[model samples]
Target: MLDGLTLDQMRVFVAVANSGSFRAGAGKVARVQSAVSHAIANLEAELGIALFDRSGHRPVLTPEGRALLANARDILLRVDAMRARARGLGEGVEPELSLVIDTLFPLEQVGAALTEMRAEYPSVAIRLSIEPLGGPVAGLLEQRCQLAVTVGEDFRDPRLELRALSAVPVVTVVAAGHPLARQAEGRTLAISDLADHLQIVLTDPTPLSEGRDFGVISPQTCRVNTQETKLALIRAGLGWGRLPLWEVERHLAEKQLVRLASHALGRSGLLVSESYLAHRIDAPLGPAARAFAQSLMQLSGPRSP
Candidate 1:
């Protein structure tokens, strides 16, 4: 009926819908519950449609409510993207970039990306810190790194701007001489099939599958930590596992290890995800950092020689 509702109102509406309660939404949107309720009430009055089916003990989206929820989320997300882009515009130009890359990342690809970055921003300094995944997030949050690379399910932090780098789903892998090598010739390897083999597994410093950890998989197994050790163990005919394609695809082609088969042992979409150059709300990033941020995005995908 009227376009008088504020962006804050729509944000509250979306948060309530997403969180399923005003209290939860307030926590999510970082406002008091009273403020959240007031925003939703204001939004409903301006829109001339009931945005929630409040009859339930908990808030539920009515048919009409569900319809508007989608549009409202779209609006708020675009507003966020715009805010980020507009902020980028003020960044003038960047001269140096500090990056903290995960230690498990393929060095070859990282080197290639850096080379392209160098050619494009010759004067820009590219400093890299290769650490465990936990360290990169802290580096970004603390302003130590302009960009970070991580995998697994996305975090709930609103400060970090995460971008999906790639998703090469997990595949089954075994040493060249494993008894199951021939069985993997066909598509789709099953987990139960590994019952007999000595499974050489990796214990990543942090969980690889994000919060979706199925639990400790104790195969008739040997445990390793870093990717290199696990790969070396696989080469020694230890056992089988679901591994990221980027890490093992080349080896599979080179006939070093045999990919068993696609499994339901699916990874968390096998993501090589990246986070933006971010600082807290009060701490603004400079033009040099902004330029480096753009360069990181441009250099993310598969690059040319």
Candidate 2:
């Protein structure tokens, strides 16, 4: 009789229980069906417990097997986690990671990625900063962050590298009660019509977006430092401006903000903006930083139309 069970045996047992058949479990573990059946049979004999009711076409977990299932899973998970941690250490995971992202990047996506990163790398300390326009790229240039998720065209900087992430659609929105929203309630607003209202714009800290404007029709503009403030001012009927469609989808559904139909901006009415992830050439990325970059890219698929 065996006093201790191997991780392979435990894996086979769990697979058989969950898959409810020896053949299916064999497929899952990539082993022959006879190998799976033998493993389970030996495991039951060694433990002196009938783990499954084998009378049926497909084996069903016996009461003892049900009780042992949770413990077996716990052990396999811990062992797998140990292997992952060792691999991560070998891959050079940084003790601390710093990141900067554009304020225009979807908050929901960022938040979800951050949550996943924390769970995957609880030992690594992470610091995140939010900036708009040039702030993201500037962070990498100044060594303020190891990685940056930014919006705009790629700059011709020899020391920096970037990957195109996703293109976000920009929607022109205003407070439901704003004059522009009321005026363009059922009709598309022309550039001339939009030029009459104040436009809310986010100011860039770096020269990247200096003297450049996108979808700004009005000569008069209200400049803000952050996206939150821009959204607030727009919601308060202070001004109208374009924002990422993902950022304002809930607000539009709630009727807190109204989308303007414009013939000039988007293909139909939505303007698309490109975003990228950048890192400095001199700064080699550690495991943690690389993982975060992957997370950022993965979320773009679901967010993109």
lDDT of each: 0.65, 0.82
Off by more than 4 A, model 2? 1-91, 154-156, 302-305
lDDT of 2 by residue, 102-133 (tens): 88787677777767777888898978899987
The weakest ten consecutive residues by lDDT in model 1 span 268-277
Clashing pairs in 2: 266-270
Can you write out model 1's per-residue Cα lDDT over 173-239, one digit (the tens) per residue?
7878788787766555555666666766654444333554332243587766666776777877777
The window of 10 residues in a row where model 2 has the poorest summed lDDT is: 152-161
lDDT of candidate 1 at residue 95, scale 0 to 100: 68
Q: Which candidate is the best by lDDT?
A: 2
